[model samples]
Target: MNFNEFELHEDVLNAVDSMNYQAATPIQEQAIPIILKGGDLLACAQTGTGKTAAYLIPILDKVAHEPHQHTAALILVPTRELAVQIDQQIQGLGYFVGATSIAVYGGNKGPEWDQQKKALSQGADIIIATPGRLIAHLQLGYVKFDQIKHLVLDEADRMLDMGFLGDIMKIMSFLPSPKQTLMFSATMPHKIGDLAKRILNDPQEVRLAVSRPAERIDQQFYMAGDNQKLPLLSHLLTQVSDTSMVLFTSRKNTVEPIVRALRKLGLKANGISSDSDQGEREQVLRSFKNREFPVLVATDVLSRGIDIDNLSHVVNYDVPRDPEDYVHRIGRTARAASKGTAITFINEADQKYVLKIERLFEKEVEKRTIPEELGLGSSPVFNARRSSGGGGHRDRGPRKGPSAEGQGNAGSKKPFRRKKPRSKSAAKAPSSTPTNSAS
Candidate 1:
C-alpha cells in the first residue's frame, strides 16, 4: 500500500514525501496505526525495518495536536548512537511542524545540554536520551516529566543486555503512571517480556516475524582458514571497491588491527569498538553516512539502531556469538527497502556455530569455497582459525602494553615483545651491574 492510504496528518505526509518514502515497511505499516491511536504498544521488529519512523511519525502527530507546556514525550534508547539517530528521525518527521527535540546521553559535556535543558524547562516537545544520561539529568533537577504523554523504549533487548533495567524502572517511576507506553525491540527476551508486563497496560502486541531479513539482500558465505580470514577479507574489499560496507568482528581487540590493516591496504576504514572515544565514533559514523569513509568495521554494539539508508553491503568477518546478532549484523544493509548484499567469512573453527545459526533460520547457509589460488591449506583445524589480524598494539607513549603473566624473569622484568631481538649486552649485564639509571 502507498503512504497516501494511511491518511496521516499533512505534516507527517509532508515529511514522508520529503524523504521520498513511497511505501511503508511491514513493521511500520502494522505499528504506526496502533501508535497513532494512542494505545500502549509492544512491537517486535528486526533492525533496518524503519522501526524508528513507525513510532516517530505517530508521536509527532500527537505532539502537533496536543500542545503542552512540559516535556511531552520521552524515548529511551540503548546507546548514545541510537539516541542520536532517533532524535534525528523525530526532527526530520516534525521539521515543518515546529516540534522540538533534544538528545541526551553521557560522553558529551553538559554545556550543550545546558541550553537544551533551559529550552526544555520553558517547554520542550520531545526528549530522546540514553537511560543513564536521562537519569543523570533527572537527578540534577534539570528535567521534569509532569506532561509526558508518550513513552518509548527503543531497542529494549539491548537495554536489558546492557544491564540498564534498573535505570529504566527508575525513570518509569518518575513519569506519570497513566501514559501511553511503547516498547520496541528486535527480540523480546524473558526479561523484556517481564518488563513489558509491568510497564504496558493491555498493549497491542505486534511481531513482524522471527528469523526474517530483508528479501532484497543476497546473502553469501566464504569458507577459508582462520589465519587467512584477514587476507581474504582484504582481498574481498579490493574486489568490491567503492561500495559502502560494514564489517563486523566478534571481539573488541580485533577492531583496531583490522582497521589498521585495511588502511595499510589503502582502503578507507574506521573501527568502532566499546573502548573507542565517543567523539571519534560519532565522526566515523558521520563520515560513513556521508560516503567520505566507505567502510566501517564494528562489533555487534552497532548491529541495531544504526540507520544508514541504502547501505549496500555487510560483511561478517567473524561469526557472532549470539545467533540473533547474525540477523542484526546483516540487517545493516538492505535498509529503507533498498537491495543489498551480505557476505560472511566462515572457517572450520566456526563450524560449531554454523549449525546453530542454520537452526535459527531452519536451513543451511549456502557455503562456497574460496578460490584455490589463495593458497589456504586444506583441512585446516579450528585452532588454525584461532587468530587473525596484526597481533601487537601500537603504544601511544612510553608505557608498555599489558605484560604476560609468569613469563618475566625473576631478576629482570621486561614485557614480552614478539619480534624484537634480545640483545645479550642489555640482558646479560642488566641485573648484576647497573652502571647508571636513566634520569
Candidate 2:
C-alpha cells in the first residue's frame, strides 16, 4: 500500500512524496500503525526491507503531534554506523515535520558531545545512542531520560550478540516503566525473545519478511578451502567485470587484507570495518555506489545497514558466524524488487553453516567451482602456494599454485589429504568461552 493510504500527516506524506517513497515496504506497512498506536512491537525483518523507515516514520509523527523538549524517545543501537544510519533516516522522513533528533555514540569528539548535549537541553525530541556511550552519559548526569515516553532497540539480535544485555537492562532502569518499547531484529534468537519478554509489555509482533531472503536474489555458493577464499573472490570479481559487489568477511581484521590483496591483483576495491572512521566508511560506500569502486569489502556490521542501489552481487568472503547473518548479507543486493546475485565462499569451516543456510532459504544453493585461473585445477587439492618465506599475515596470504583436481601440470605427485571436517559442536567452544573480542 502507498504511504498516503496510511493516513499519515500531510507533511509526512509530503516528505514521503519528495523522497519518492511511493509504496510502503512490508515492514513499513505492518509496523507504522502498530507503533503509531503506542503499542510495543517485536518485528522480524531483514535489512533492505525498509525496516528503519518503518519505525522512524511513526516515531516522527508522534513527535510532530505532541512536541516535547525532553528526550521523549530513546533508540539504543549496537554500533555507531547504525546509530548514524537511523538518525539519517529520521532526518529524511521527518525533515518537513521539523522533528529534532540527536545521535550520541562513542568516537565522537568531546566538543561534539558537548554541542549535542547543549542541543538536548534546548529540546531534542529524540535521542539515538549506543548502549555503552549512552550509559556513560547517564552516569555523568548529561542525559535526561526521565521524560522518555518511547524506547526502541534496533538490531536487538546484534545488541544481544555483542554482550549488551546488561547495559540494556541498566538503561531500561532509567526509562519510565510505562513507556512504549519497540524491538526490531533481523532474526529472533532465543535471547532476543527472552529480552523482549522482560522489556515489552504484551507487544504486538510483526513477522513481516520473516527470515526469508529477498525473492529477487539468485543465491549460490563457491566451494573452496579457507586459504582459497580471497583468490577465488578476486577471480570471481574479475569474471563479473564492472558489477558493484560487496565482499563480506566474518572478522573485522579480514577486511583490510582482502582489500589490499584485491588491489594487488589490480582490482578497484576498498574495505570498511568497525575500526574504520565514519568518514572513511561513508567514502567507501559512496564510491562503491557511484561505481567509482566496483568492489567494497565489509564485515557483518556493514551487512545490515548499508543500502546501495542496484548492487549486482554479494560475495561472502568468510562464512558468517551466525547463519542468520548470511541471509542479511545477501539481501543487500536484491532489493526493491530488483534481481541480484549472492555468492558465498564455503570452506571446510563453513560446511556446518551451509546446511543451516540451505534450510533457512529452503533451497539448495547452486555450488560452483572456483575459476581455473586461481589454480583450482592443480594436481593436488592442497597445492600449497609458493610463499614469500615470511610468517604472520604473509603466511595467510593467498596461494599461488594450481590444484591437481582439474589438471596434471608440472606439480607434486603427492596426494592432497584433507583432514576430516570437524563437527559443529566441536568446531567452536561453548558460547560462554572467552574468545577474543571483535574489534
Candidate 3:
C-alpha cells in the first residue's frame, strides 16, 4: 500500500517522499490503519520486515497532526543501539514534520543523562528508551507521561530474553491505562502473548511469518580447529574484500583481539560491545555505517542494533549458542532484498551448535574441509568433506576459502527441536551472555 492511501498530513507526506519511501511494507500496511484508528496492536514481524517504520510512521503522523508538547509516544527497545537507531529514524522521517524525540539508554555520561532528563521534563513527541534506563528516569520523578497516548514495546521478545519484563511493567504503571498500546516482536512466545494480553485491550494482530536471511545470502561454513578459526576467518575476509561486514563472536572481550588481528591482515575493522559507553558505541556504529571501516567485530549486542542495508557480509566467528541469535546476526546483512554472504567458523566446541542450527534451518549447510596448507588441524571428530566451491578452487593455495552451504529461504517453518521433558534439568542457558557474542 502507498503512503497516499493513509490520511497522513502533508508534512508527513513530504517527509516520507524525502526519505524515498514509496510504499508501505506488509507490516506497515496492516498495522498502521489499525493504529491510526486508535486500536491496540500486537504485530509479529522479524527484523528486516520494515517493522520499525510500521510503528514509527503512524505514531509520528498522529503526533505531528495533533501537535503534542508532552511525551506523546514511549517506545521501549532492547538495546542502546536500537534506541539510537529508532531515534535517528524519527529525526529523519519527522524532519519536516518537526517531531521531537530522545533515546534513553544506560552507559551514558552525566551530561547525556542531563539531556535526557531535560527532554522528558520539557516535552517531545516521542521518547525511545531501553526498559532499564527508562525506569531509572521514572524513579527521578521528573518524567511527565500524562500526555503519552502511544506506547510501543519494540523487540519485546529480546527484552524478555534480557530479563527486562519487570522493568517494562514498572514503566507502564506510570502511563495512563486508556492509551493505545502496541507490541511488536520478531517472535511470538507464550511470554509475549501474556504481556500483550496484560497491556493491549482488544488488540488487532498482524502476524508475519518468521523472517530468514535474504535468499541472495550465499552461506558457507568452515570446520576449523579451535586454534585455526582465526586464520580461516582472515583468509575468507581477504577473498570478500571491499564490502562491509559484521563478524559475530559470542563474547565481548574477544571483540578487540579479533579486530586487532583483522587489522594486522590490512583490514579496516572496529569492535563494539556492551562494555563500551554510549558515546563510544555510537561513534563505532557511525563509522561502520559511513563505510569508514569495512568490518566490525561484535557480539549479539548488535544482532538487533546493526541494521545497515548495504552490509554485505556476516561472519559467525563464534557459532551462537541460541539458534534465534544466528537468525538475527545473519539477517544484519542481505537486507531490503539485497544479495549478501554469510560465513560461519565451526570449531569442535561449536560443532554441536552447527547441527542444531542446521536442524532449525531444516537443511544441512555443507561442511567444508579447511585447506591443509594453512595448517589449522581439522576438528578431531569432523570428517573432512570435498570442496564445493568447484573448478580450480582446490589450487588457489593460500587463497583457498571456506565452504559454501545453506538451507531454507529466509527462516524455517518447522518447530525448533525440543528436549525431552525432564524433571530438575539442573542446567539452563546463561542469560547475560557476556561471552556468548564476544569471543
Candidate 4:
C-alpha cells in the first residue's frame, strides 16, 4: 500500500516521499491504521522488513496533527545502536513535520547525559532509549512521562533476553495509564506474550511469517577445527570479490584477536565489541559502512538492529546458540532484494548449534569441505547427535593465547570442555552487553 492510503498528515507524507519510500511494508500495512486509530498493537515481523518505519511514520503523523505539549511517544529499544538508528529515522521522517526526538542510551560520557536530561526535561516530541539509561534518568526524579500518549517496545524479545523485564516494567510505571502501547518483535516467545498481557490493552495483532534467509543468499557451511577457522576464513576472504563483509563471533574477547589476525593476512578489517567505548563503536560502524574497511569483526552486539546496506557477505565465525540469531546475523546481507553470501564455520562442538539453525531453515544447509590447499588437516566429522552432549569450549572466559581467538597454528590442540547452561537466576542478571545502562 502507498503512504497516501494511510491518510497521514500532509507533511508526514511529504517527508516519506522525500525519503523515497514508495510502498508500505507488510508490518506497516497492517499496523499503521490500528496505531492511527489509537489502538495498541502487537506486531511480529522479521529484521530488515522496515519495522522501524512501520511505527515511526504513524507516530510522526500523530505528533504533527495532534496537540501535545509534552513528549508524545516513548520507544524503548534493546541497544544503544538501535536507539540511535531509530532517532535518525525520526529525524528524516519527522523533518517536514517538525517533530523532535532524543535518543537516551548508556555508555556515553557526561555531555551526552546532560543533553539527554535537557531533552527529557524539556519534552522532546519523542524519546528513544535503552531501558537502563532511561531508568537512571527516571530515578533522579527529573524525567516525566505522565503525558506520554504512545509507548513502544521495539525488539521486545531481545529486551527480555537481556533481562530488562524488571527495568521495562519500572519505566512503564512512570508513563500515564491507558496510553497506546505497541510491542514489536522479530520473534514471539511465550515471554513476549506475557509481557503484552501485562502492558498492552486489548492490542490488535499483526504477525508476518518468520523470515527465512533470502533465496538470493547463498548459504554455505564449512567443517573446521577451532585452529583452522582463522586461516580458512582468510582463504575464503581472498576468494570473494566483494569485501563488504561482517564476521560475527559470539564472544566479545574474540573480536580484536580475529581482526588482528585478518589484518596480518593483509586484509582490511576492524573490530568492535561492548568493551569498545560508545564513541569508538560508532566510529567503527561508520567506517565499516563507508567501506573504509572491507571486514567488520564483532560480537552478537551487531547481530540485531545495526543496519549497513549493500553488505555482500556475513561470516558466522561462531554459530549462534539461538536459531533466530543465526537468521539475524545473515539477514545483515541479502537486504532489499539484493544477492549476498552467508558462510558459517562449524567446529566439532558447534555442530549441534548448526543442526538447530538448519532446522529453522527447514532443510539441511550445504556443508563444504575446508580447502585442502591450506593444509588445515582433516575437518571434524559432522555428527550433531554425538556432539549434542556439549564437547565444545564455550566462547567465554579469559583469553590466554593466539588459540584463544581461533588464530592458533593449524595443529594446535585445545581441549574441548562442556559449557553448562546458565541457571535461571544467572540468566536474570543485568546484561553485561554494552546496550544496557549501568543503572
Candidate 5:
C-alpha cells in the first residue's frame, strides 16, 4: 500500500514525499499500523526489506504528535554504521516534522561524548545507541530512560548473536516499568524468541521471508585454487568498469593483502576490518560509497548492517563458515528491489563452507571454472552439479548446536558493568566494548 493510504501525520507524509518514498515495503505496511497503535511487536524481517523505515516512520510519527522533549523513543542497533544510518534516516523521514535524534556509540573523541551527553541530558526526542556506550553514559548518572515511551531493538537477533543479551537486559532495567517494546530481527532463533518472551508484553508478530538472500541477486561462484583466486577476482572486476563492490574475507589479516593486490592491478580499493578504528571505518565506507573507491575489502564486520545505495556487486574473497553469514554478505548487494551480482571464490579449503551454503539455499550455486590464463583449470575437488554434500580434506563431522551466545540463560544474569576509563591514556585510546553490547 502507498504510505499516503496510512494517513500518517501530515508532516510525516510531506517528509515521505520529499524523500521520494512512494510505497511502504511489506514489512513497513504490516509494521506501521501495529506500532502506531502502541502495540508491542516482534517482526521477522531481513536487511533489504526496509526494516529501518518500518520502525522509524511510526516512531517518528508518534514523537511528532506527542511532542515529548525527553528521549521519547530509544533504538538499539548492532553496529556503529547502523546507528549512524538509522539516525540519518530519522533525519530524512522526520524532516518536515522537525524530529530530533542523537546517535550514541563509542569510537568517538571527547567532543562527541560531550555532544551525546548534552543531548541525553537535555532530552533528544529519539536516541539511537549501541549497548556499551549507553551503559557508559548510564554509569555517568545524568542519563534518562524513565520517561522513554518507546523502545526498539532493531537487529535484535544480531545483538543476541553478538552476546549483547546481558547488556540489553541491563538497559531495560533502567526504563520505566511500563513501556512499549518492539523487536525487529532477521531471524527468530530460539534465543530471539526467549528474548521476546522477556522484553515484550504479548506482542503481535510480523514474519516475512527471512535468512535468505534477495531473489534479485544473480548468484555465481568461481572454482579457483589458492594460486588463482586473486586472478579470478581481478578478472571479474576488470570485465566491468567503475563497479561499486564489497569484497568479504574471513580474517582481518587477509584484508590488507587483497586490497593491495587489487590496487596493484589498477582498481581503486580500500579495506576495513576489526583493526580499523570506528572513525577510519566510517571514512572508508564514506569513500567507498562516494565512488572515490570502486572496491572495498571488508571482514564480516561489514557483512550485516552498512547501507550502500546502488551497490553493484559483492565478492566473497573467503568463504564464510556460517550459512547465515553467507546470506548477510550477499545481502549487501541486491538491496531494496535492486538487482546485483554476488560472486564467491571456492578453493579446496572453501568446499565444506560452500556445501553448507548450498544446503541453506536448497540448491547448488552455479560454479564458473577459472580461465586457463588465470593459471587454473576447472576444480577437480568436487563436481559442482553433484557435490557429495561432503567435500574437502577434513571431515566436517556434524553441525554444532547453538552456542552460549544463543542461550536464553545468557540474558537472565547481569554482567559486571565497567565505568569508561578515565586516565588520559585510557580515555584517548580507541577501545571496544563487547561487540554484542547493544548491537
Candidate 6:
C-alpha cells in the first residue's frame, strides 16, 4: 500500500515522498490505519520490517493536526543506539510536519542531562528514551507526562530480557490513563503477553510470520577450535573482496583483542562495547557508517536496532547464547531485499547452540572445511549430543602447514570453494508443529 492510501496529512506525505518511500511495508500497511484512528495496537514485527516508521508517521500526522502543550508521545526502547536511531527517523519523517523530538539516553556528561531536563520540563512533541535514563530524570521530579497521548514500548521482549520491567512500570506510573498504547516485539514470550495484558486496553493485534533470514543471505557455518578460529577468520576475510562487515562477539573483552588481531593482519577494523563511552561509541558507529573502516568488531549491543545500510557481510565471531539472537545478528545484512552473507565460527563448546539455531531456521546451515594452508590443527567435527554435554570429540592433532604468521594475504591464494547447494526437498523440510505468534 502507498502512504497516500492511508489519507495521512499532506505535509506528512510530502516528507515520506522526500524520503523516497514508495510503498508501505507489511507492518506499516497494517499498523498505520489503526494508529491514525486513535486505537491501541499490539504488533509482532521483527527488525527491518519498517516498524519505526509504522508508528512514527501516524504520530507525526496526529501532532500536525492537533494542538498540544506538553510532550505528546513517549517511545521507550532497549538501548541508546535504538533511541538515537528512532529519533533520527523522526527528524526525517516529521520534517515537513514540524514535529519536535529528542532522544533521552544515559552514558553522557552533565550537559546531556541538563538538555534532557529542559526538553522534559517544557515539552517536545515526541520523546524517545531508554527506560533507565528516563527514570533518572523522572526521579528528579521535573519530567512531566500528564499530556502524553501516545505510549509505545518498542522491542518489548528485549527490554524485558535486559530486566527493564520495573523501570518500565515506574515510568508508566507518571503517564495519564486512557491513552493509546502500542507495543511491538520481535518475539511473543509469556512475559510480553503478561505485560501487555496489564498495560494495553483491548488493543488490536497484528502478527506477522516468524521472520526467517532473507533468501538473499548466504548462511555458512565453520567448525573450528578456539585457538584455530582467528586464523580461520583471517583466512576467510582475505578470500572476500572489498566488503562492509560487522563481526559480533558475545563477550565485550574479546572485542579489542579481535580488532587488534585484524589490524595486525593489515585489515582496518575498530571495536565498540558497553565499556566504550557514549561519545566514542557514537563516533565509531558514525565512522563505520561513513565507510571509514571495513570491519566493525562489536558485542551484541550492535545486534538489535543499529541500522547500517549496504552491509555486505556479518561474522559471528562467537555464537549467541539465545537462538533468536542468531537471527537478529545476521538480520543486519540482507536488509531491504539486498543480497548479503552471514558467516559463523563455531568452536566445540558452541556446537549445541548451532543445533538450536538450525532448529530455529528449520534447516541445517552449510558447514565448510577449514583451509588446509592455515594448518592450525584438525578442526572438531560437530556432534550435537556430545557438545550439548559441554564435551567435544578429541582432535587428531595439528596438521602440517604454515603458521598464521605472514599468512595475512591469503586472499591472493586460491579462493575458498563452498559446498554444493542442497536439494529443494532437504531445504524445505516440514515442521511437525505449528508456529506460534508472540502473545
What C-alpha lDDT values do all the predictions have? 0.71, 0.70, 0.74, 0.79, 0.76, 0.79
Better of 3 and 6 by lDDT: 6
Instruction: Compose the digit string of candidate 1's lDDT tens values, residues 177-209.
Output: 688999999997788789999999999999976
* Each prediction's TM-score versus the true structure: 0.83, 0.82, 0.85, 0.89, 0.86, 0.88
Candidate 1 vs. true structure, TM-score:
0.83
Error of 2 at 391 (Å): 26
lDDT of 5 by residue, 1-439 (tens): 9998885877788877877886899999999999999999999988888888888888888987885657889999988788888887876776578777888988877778888888888778888999999999988888877689999999898899889999999999889867889999988899999999998999999999988889899888887654455555666666675588998877666566656555555566799898888778888888888889788988888888778999999988657878888888999998877899999877665677778888888887777786666443455455544445554354232122212222111001111121121211001101111011000
User: TM-score for model 3?
Assistant: 0.85
- Candidate 6 lDDT at 129 equals 96
- Residue by residue across 1-439, what tens digits does model 2's lDDT show? 9888885788777777777887898889999989888999999888888888888888877877774557788899998777776776766766677766767777756576775666555546788889998887778766677778889999889889889999999998878778889999989878988998999899999886667888888877777655555545555555565588887876676566556555555566788888887667767766777899777888777777667788999988655656788887888897887899888765544555566676677766666776665554421121112211211131232233222221111000111121221211001111111011121
Residue-wise lDDT of candidate 3 within 1-439, one digit each (tens)? 8998997877777877878886888888999899889999999987887899888888988987785558889999999888878887887887777677888888877777888888888866788999888888889899989899999999999999999989998998899868999999988889999999888899999998674555778888877544455556666655564689888877666676666555554566789888877678878888888899888888889998547978888988777767778888888887776888898876555666676677778888888777766554554354223212111111111122222111000000111121131211011111111122223
Query: Ten residues in a row with the worst lDDT in model 2?
Result: 425-434
Q: How do all the candidates rank in terms of lDDT, highest first?
A: 4, 6, 5, 3, 1, 2
Off by over 4 Å in 4: 389-400, 403-439
| Arranged by TM-score, best first | 4, 6, 5, 3, 1, 2
Model 1 RMSD vs true structure: 13.8
Q: What is the RMSD of candidate 5?
A: 11.0
Which lDDT value does model 2 have at 151? 91
User: Could you tell me the C-alpha RMSD of candidate 3 in Å?
Assistant: 13.0
Candidate 5: stretches off by over 4 Å: 377-380, 383-439
lDDT per residue as tens, model 6, 1-439? 8899997977888888888887999999999999999999999877787888899889889976787888899999999999988888877777677777888998988778787888888887889999999998898998888889999999899999999999999998999988999999988888989999989999999987555667788888987655556556666666678689998877666676667656656668899999999889988999999999999988889888878899999988767868889888998998887899998887666777788888788887777777666656677787767856755443332222222232331101111121121211001111111100110
What CA RMSD would you report for each candidate? 13.8, 13.5, 13.0, 11.2, 11.0, 11.7
Clashes of each: 1, 7, 11, 0, 3, 1
